[model samples]
Target: MRIGDYKVSYGADEAVFRTGTVRVWMIVLFLAMAVFPFWAGDYLLYMANLTGIAIVAAVGLNILTGAAGQISLGHAAFVGIGAYTSAILITKLGLPFIICLPLSGLSAALFGVIVGAPSMRMKGLYLCIATLAAQVIFEYLFKNWESLTGGIRGINVPAPTIFGFEFNNEFRFYFITVPVVIIVVTAARNLFRTRVGRAFIAIRDRDFSAQLMGINLFRYKLYAFALSSFLAGVAGCLWVNFIKIVTPEHFPLHESIRYLAMIIVGGLGSVLGSIFGAIFMTIIPEVLKSMLNIVSAFSPDAMAYLSPLQTVVFGLLIVVFLVFEPHGLAEMWRRVKDYFRLWPFEH
Candidate 1:
């Protein structure tokens, strides 16, 4: 809200951009994003694309676990399904990447329903275990299905082209991801405003209570799973296209845990938090690697400890956030904004 902004009507009170200032800022932000490719280096562009993909996946996980209060450790498997589905269709069936992207998401959503079937009878830790087991089963299938997935060999994806324009470099490809991310993020931000989104939140808060209020526990639970998995699937499709390769080993349990850590660190129930978490999780390793390289160069003995040190730093970052800031970085961000807004005020 602007400093002197006031809602004159109910619609104004509920609007996304309540003030003209925020909308102007948003326009400026998009304008800057539009020109980022021209000014940024290849590495920065790569990170931007990578972060965008992770944001998509993190937001999906946040929807299931954060908004719906459903625990899923099998999220990576859904993403893997998306990647493989898109890759197989593109490679084997000669389908365009654009068409395969949503189709891949739908494929994963189908599996999401199957996996969510256990949710009707399970909750909390039991449900977490069920999803965790699903990951194992999914991974086994990914690894064992040698013919389709290429097994340990992996499959390559050709660079996508649209209307005679090839997205061969990160700069050009940023157009594809930036728009998709914007759309996904915008949809996610608006989703909670709708009845179905409210139903998901109600189920998350207390499924039994939600059921008493006429919300179908089974149906909404599966809906949450399908929606969440579809987002993850889209992320997976983006990953395969960006990386230009699909491997069974790419989606592992640690990756799933990493996405969970991201949402938790970013703030579970916030859309912006997903983007924050994805950026932090993706960039930190690169930051740690850079620091470690300097240390290892000065002392070769430190080379042996590089991997474990980075792991320790990552674990510590999560532990610090969980222990002292359970609400995550989004809460921290709000406090900063509040402080700025209330500057010069007296207690």
Candidate 2:
């Protein structure tokens, strides 16, 4: 296949597993995951759970911001909605966890469509503001809506069960999360190869041009919002299950920023990047916290200030990456692999 001025070989064009090496790496990854629960400690399993949740959320945001070119600053609101919905459904309505999770996703999708209706008349910063407004409204409702949300006190969530088998331990939850993560990531990757996904990309690149080419910008924009919200809602449901609670404080503005950072740091439109971003962001703080603990042991004054220092460091890292490697860690990996493949051909 030829695109523009470049020629793509049959292997290059058709290949997701482009080489034998990649296939082997994938096999290794599967094997590692299969055995992870046996070897990994409780903390590591917890971290993996966090990574899975983040990856799910990041991929959803990527669908909105990267593929659809729609800026959203309130994705966490959808997550909150999903969590609370699931909690209420299970606790109040006596719905099973299995039914509640999907219901939560559907509820979020409905809200997403409502939010996306205005997207036809808005773009860029305006759309961002609209989403931001939604986020604030959701937070206010969660806090003040005492009858349903339980006000600022929040609500407790029960452990998830599948056919009478309870997933209460981190190890059991890890198994649940890993499979869900893989399924979501695979679905997201394949989404871009379909007509709906292509429409999103076309509209994202140039809405006027897409409309001229027979794509309905308004319909597709709404679709993007629905899909993104669905994914966020699923992530939220999983998150509440992991934490065993649904609190207004869990879905804050900072979480929205973290999701944005994950997509940006991972790679805007790449599925692999979303996973990388989630894992990196989730683990980095724990690593830093451990280092801080060691420092605190030696200096109590430094210990007292470690929290602010960690925040500063995290902020600095984000800034540096944005400035120097805007394409993100995924792009960086691509460059290194390309360099190796094209070795001795100094361009």
How does each model score on TM-score?
0.97, 0.93
Q: Write the per-residue lDDT of candidate 1 for residues 132-172, one digit (tens) a residue.
A: 99999999988999999999778899998777788888998
Q: Candidate 2 lDDT, tens digit per residue, 1-347?
A: 11142336875756666666678989999999999989999988998898998898899989988889998888999999889898888788878877877788889889999988999899989999999998889989988999999988888888999899999989999988998888999899889978999998998899999999999899999999999999899898888888998878988887888888888888887888888888888888888888878888788766677678778877876898899988788999988877776676736
What TM-score does model 1 achieve against the real structure? 0.97
Among all candidates shown, the one with the greatest lDDT: 1
Off by over 4 Å in 1: none
- Candidate 2 stretches with Cα past 4 Å from truth are 1-15, 343-347
Per-residue error (Å), model 1, residue 223:
0.7
